[model samples]
Target chain A: MSEQYVEEGDRRREIIEAALRVFSERGFGGATIKEIAREAGIRSPALIYWYFKDKRALFQEVLGAKVPVVRAVADLARVMDLPPEEALTKLGRAYFAFERMDARVLRLVIGEAIRRPEVAEAFVRAGPGRVLEFLKRYLERQIELGRLRPHDVRSGARMFVGMLIPQLAGKLFFPAMVEDGLTDEEHLRNAVETFLRGLAPES
Target chain B: MSEQYVEEGDRRREIIEAALRVFSERGFGGATIKEIAREAGIRSPALIYWYFKDKRALFQEVLGAKVPVVRAVADLARVMDLPPEEALTKLGRAYFAFERMDARVLRLVIGEAIRRPEVAEAFVRAGPGRVLEFLKRYLERQIELGRLRPHDVRSGARMFVGMLIPQLAGKLFFPAMVEDGLTDEEHLRNAVETFLRGLAPES
Candidate 1:
């Protein structure tokens, strides 16, 4: 891209980042364009309209960026020919790492997704649903290979995702819980072990 | 208590009901005393202060009242002597019932709890921590009885609770997922069974 194009792209990214912070702090409806512009170090709220159509458009851009992080992990699982247990372990580690790195953005996505039906639908369709589909197919293959038990694919997918949410959310919303020594890497590993054990087939 | 006391108590309950609806709709920071007073069919916001001191106090009262719903379910596990699986099934049913009955309050509590650490702390202390404690003890007992594998209670408890959250959240944020002809009872039973299977000992 040209220098001017690159600069415009940088500005758009900056605005989205600032919007994520403001939206995560004050929520979607509560956040103002002026505050977002101020956070981005811009004088005019109209600049946001130049790059994005409106506040809703800007919100969608921020949300849209979050999908690929999870999607990339799911995509990794597809190309790997690892054992079921190993695949799950790798996926879990990736998920945990993602949460640790981009916790604020994750919270912003989850918070808005829960409160707004449109956001939830968009996220589920674009992100979670795709991940679940991949997991379901993988598990089905494992079941066919006699590596796992026959179970409802959807419920099993849900169970797998559910295993990670508490710790992920704890680390996000209750940092004190982690600071108080309740949610360290050891605890997370142990929880993962228990969850994996639960998924193991009859000996 | 006299008839006058009973009438006053009823009025207090009415006010709380209105406050919950208003708070859930507009959120803690967004909601106003005037709106709550109006919802309660009272002429002035002064009655809200007279009953509960301030908005924070009224919010606390609402939180306090709902804490027992989870606690009572946990207590049920202790008082009833049943097989581990059976007890868990009952617990799952009770949990699902509570979520279904008061989905709005649950959402409000979760959303506000995210914004206000104090609200989250109060909820964790009263409801979530108690449930985790009960589950830990119960699972430990099962381990001692040679019913479950030797496992850390905390990890086991986290997995169990983690399993329920998505379903609870899905019921609220994605009602259309359930509107496709599955009754709430069926969904709850499915989740409980999947979780129980996950927790079962290796055959």
Candidate 2:
């Protein structure tokens, strides 16, 4: 890439990083672009507009950068060839690991999402919505390959995701109650196995 | 009950109702007893002290009263004799129905729980923690009765709950994405079946 293009990319990354911090501290409705520009050390607040359309677009960009699920779904193509059990376990393990790492930011986004419908819409579109869409397509592909049973891939995708989220959420939000239960490995194993059994092709 | 006893009970309920309103608007940290008393139409803020020990205790009571899962688990004894599928279906159905009705308040508590650790603990203890504990006990009972396979009942309960929550959360937080997919009945059916199939006894 040209030097000018690379510099623009770097500036965009810096702006998004600053936006994440400001958004986490103040939430979607409460955060201001001028403050984000200040945090980013940009000389002019209006310069941010050169990169993003508006505050909402900047917020969306922040969520896209922060939520690992976005990257996971993007990378789903690499594991598309694996059988359902192996692929899902890989996906689930990676999802939980990244989620643990991103727990603080994720919690802040979720908190905001609950209070603000627009934030909730942005969050779902950038994170779970994309993941669910990718998962449903994967389920359909697997069923076509005769490795899985035909069913409502939307709900099937939901069921698999459903199996994973509550555990992560419980650990993040209620560490006291999580108290020495199944190890993460065991939990992932059980979750994957249970999901596979439920979706196993009929004889 | 005597007139004085009846009056005390009514006053306590009124205070809890008022506390819910204030907490919903201002969150756990922002809400104050004085505001709650005013909302409750009590001349003395100290009267809230007689009803609840403190703000945290009052927050706990609001969660307990608003979250249907709390009452569902409390009444688990009535369905304990039923088979696993039958019992779980009933419990899950009740949970979703109540959750839909209480979505606004539950969302408020969840939003606060992320920002405040104490609220997280109280929320879990008053809602999901008790529900998980009761479900774990119920799973153990079913396994002993040979209606379900024996395994880690803790994880078993988590898996079952894990299946239900994401669906509810998705619907609550992202109506745009849930549009015209599986109906609530279909989603619940798939979740319960998947969980049951995973835990079925070996032939």
Candidate 3:
């Protein structure tokens, strides 16, 4: 392979990564191609133009690139016979870490969903919507196995997500508002335990 | 009293209410004084300018007007002799209702806080900041009374608030994304129950 080809490939990936952050931080209307180029540290937008036709195309590319994070959360659902609490704890940690890894994306999709109609549906399908579905499936399995409490799967999944939101979304996106200094691991443990306790069948 | 005086007073209140919705719908940067005027049904920006110096003043006023919602949460914490779980349940419902009453304000503060540093601190003090502090104090009292599980006041409070965020913040702001058909009352009951169950002391 030619050295130039490798460099070009690296640059494309870098641009996409930068665009993802930029678009997430500033929604489509707020973010410009030039700013994306600037975020990517590319001096010439003509170079970005060479890769993407316009800001919409770049945004679509960025959203498409995020498919893997959703897949990673879905992957967390696939596991062997661990206890229900431990299984949920592990999955909770993975979900929190996945969100913290790219905090801007959640906030971006959430904030701009109103302005950009398509982004909301696209994001939920690629992000929380899938995770909620996976979580319900996991919870149903636990109930069938009698290893966990039976409850409203839909609302229960939302409650678990609710516990995750404070540190994962709140602290990550708005650090000033959240004063808890606990690392992501600590917060996740606390959140997951609380959620499991809530879900535990009356002993 | 003069009719003009009554009309002027109503007009000022109208502008503030309109500005509140507009700011919450559009962040600080996105909302313009003209748009606010339009939102209030005022034909002239000059009419708005007569009431306030600028958009910042209008926003500050709006924030000031939101003190009641925060107080409602604080009041929930003050009831005498309720068990810890019931106290929190009542508070959770109050908090949820408060957020729902004006969903746009919550979204507006959360979104613009990233860009506007001052708004985050001020709004938090007036909104979630006060609620969290009040909640922690209430929980500490409950733990001392041996009615609730021993836990980090901060983390416990975060967990409680976490349970509220999904519906309060998500549904109103991004209606397209959140498809849960549950009414506000149903969602609130589920959240409050899960939160209390999470905090239940060891049997």
**lDDT ranking, high to low:** 2, 3, 1
Q: Which ten residues in a row have the lowest lDDT in candidate 2 chain A?
A: A93-102
Clashing residue pairs in candidate 2, if any?
none
Per-residue lDDT of model 1, residues B1-203, tens digit only: 43245477887987888987887787766778899999988777887787987777777666545544364554554644566677776666655656432666666666666657876665465466656667778788877777777776676766676666666666777543333344445545555665555556666
Q: What is the lDDT of residue A48 in candidate 3?
A: 91
Candidate with maximal lDDT: 2
Docking class of 1: acceptable
Tens-digit lDDT track for model 2 on B1-203? 43345588798888888988888777777789999999988878987898889887887788777766676677777978888778888878867776543677777778888768887887777778888888999999989998888888877888888777667786777675686467777888888887888788887
**Model 1 root-mean-square deviation:** 5.6
Comparing candidate 1 with candidate 3, which one achieves the higher DockQ? 3
Candidate 3 lDDT score at position B180: 63
- Candidate 3, residues B1-203: lDDT per residue as tens digits? 53355588898888988888787777766789999989988778988999898776776667656644465554653553577657666666665555443655666666666445566665565566666777777778788887778987777877777776666654655453357665556766776677677877787
Instruction: Supply the DockQ value of model 1.
Output: 0.32
Report the poorest 10 consecutive residues by lDDT, candidate 3 chain B: B169-178
lDDT, each prediction:
0.65, 0.79, 0.68
lDDT of 3 by residue, A95-164 (tens): 6555442556655566666445566565555566766777777777777877668777767777777777
True-structure lDDT of candidate 3: 0.68
Candidate 1 clash figure, as a count: 0
Interface RMSD of each: 3.3, 1.5, 2.3
Candidate 1 regions exceeding 4 Å error are A1-71, A74-80, A98-101, A175-184, B1-3, B7-22, B25-71, B74-80, B98-101, B175-203
| Off by more than 4 A, model 3 | A1-71, A98-101, B1-71, B74-77, B98-101
